[model samples]
Target: MEELIKRVEELEKNTQKSSRERELLLNRICELEDLVEDLTLQLKKSKKTIRTPVAPKESLAINNASKKTNAQEDEPWLFYCPKNKPYEEILRNLDFSEGYEITSSALVSEEALWTQILEKMNEEEIPKKLTALRKLVSVQLSSACHHELLIIVRGIPGNENPLFQLILPHIATLAEYVNIAWSEVENSNPELLGRIALVLECEQDLKVLSVDRGDTRLSLYVEKLL
Candidate 1:
């Protein structure tokens, strides 16, 4: 009877020990699960933080470039009469060069030049848009009795002014661009529609060169583009 009692006590102690061990193991498993959840949450937060700045930073560049390339697409130059920009327009206002302004035919804008360049090309591709930009033939006509038109068409490096990015490298190819300028001038001024006289700018003086189309034609002795 004593031996049976001892066996019972031993069995009870072993069962208690096993129960404590199981409880400890369960606690450990719960701790591991909590750690895994915390780690997963941290990983998600980290991904969000990384994407916030990186994505917009890349997209901003493309957005700016597209805006610049396609700026004032609905307006094209008819005729800008200014031979030189005003002091306030030129002097330290480099911003004036990039942020071009345009106004409708009812009136002109602060930056009236861009209005004459591009007019409605939302469907054009980038290269075609640039081609349209390069094809600008600047012709300035005076309203006086003397019908003299100044043609200022040249392709400058894109850095100086984004607008006048011309491509006339050789002197021989000048007449083609001149014809383009002539057409623009004719359309703008109805008086010079029939014909005009060429008062060529020679040195500091004006020299008259005759070209007949019914009236007088004025040709400027164009200087070497600096």
Candidate 2:
């Protein structure tokens, strides 16, 4: 009976030892699973960081495209004119540097000349004749006529002369080449002042009327009358 009881105790001890070993193995598996899950989360975070650089590059490309579009839109429209010879041809024909000065006295003479013409037409009695001068200007846009127009402007006190204001735009339209001596005329008269104001107002409607003030270079530019 003692020997049988001892054998039963030994079997119980062996069974208890097997249960403890199985429990330990399960705990180890659970810990390993937790470690694998942590590594997977870290790997996902790394991939996200790597993708971050691509977003800024795309943003930069969009900005550049927008800037180019704005630049194109901001460009100004060119003046419309009838077809004429190239600008270079005009440039080759004129000499701006010499004989450009119109003395104040000469300018006075020009003003007097217009005064006489206006008086002869009885401009006060017929104000519409003054209006007709604008039409006459359009009819005579030739080089000789352009010279006469310039002479008319040179003498008139642009600020004082209503006639100058009326005629200055037509003059600008016909000016193929222009050279003004600042020494001879620097805001000297109201008529010149009026002409300058007209130039600014009509800039959009006129071609680039380059002015060479106080310089000695004569270049031809074509002024087309439409």
**Per-model tally of clashing residue pairs:** 15, 13
Question: Per-residue CA lDDT of candidate 2, range 1-226, in tens?
Answer: 9999999999988887875674455456556766898999998888745433332221111111111111233211112232232333322332111111121222233233333434433343211232233332222222222222222122323335565454443343323222232111222331232111011112123333332323322222223322
Could you estimate the TM-score for every candidate?
0.22, 0.21
Runs in model 1 lying further than 4 Å from the true structure:
49-226
Shift of residue 77 alpha carbon in model 2, Å: 84
What lDDT tens digits, residue by residue, belong to model 1 across residues 50-167? 4443322221111111111012232111122232344344212222212222222212221222223233212111122222223322222222112322223222223243332222
When summed lDDT is taken over every stretch of 10 residues in candidate 1, the lowest stretch is 60-69
On the 0 to 100 scale, the lDDT of residue 53 in model 2 is 38
Candidate 2, 17: how far from true, in Å?
0.6
Q: What TM-score does candidate 2 reach?
A: 0.21
Candidate 2 wrong stretches, greater than 4 Å: 49-226
Candidate 2 lDDT for residue 183: 11
Error of 2 at 210 (Å): 84
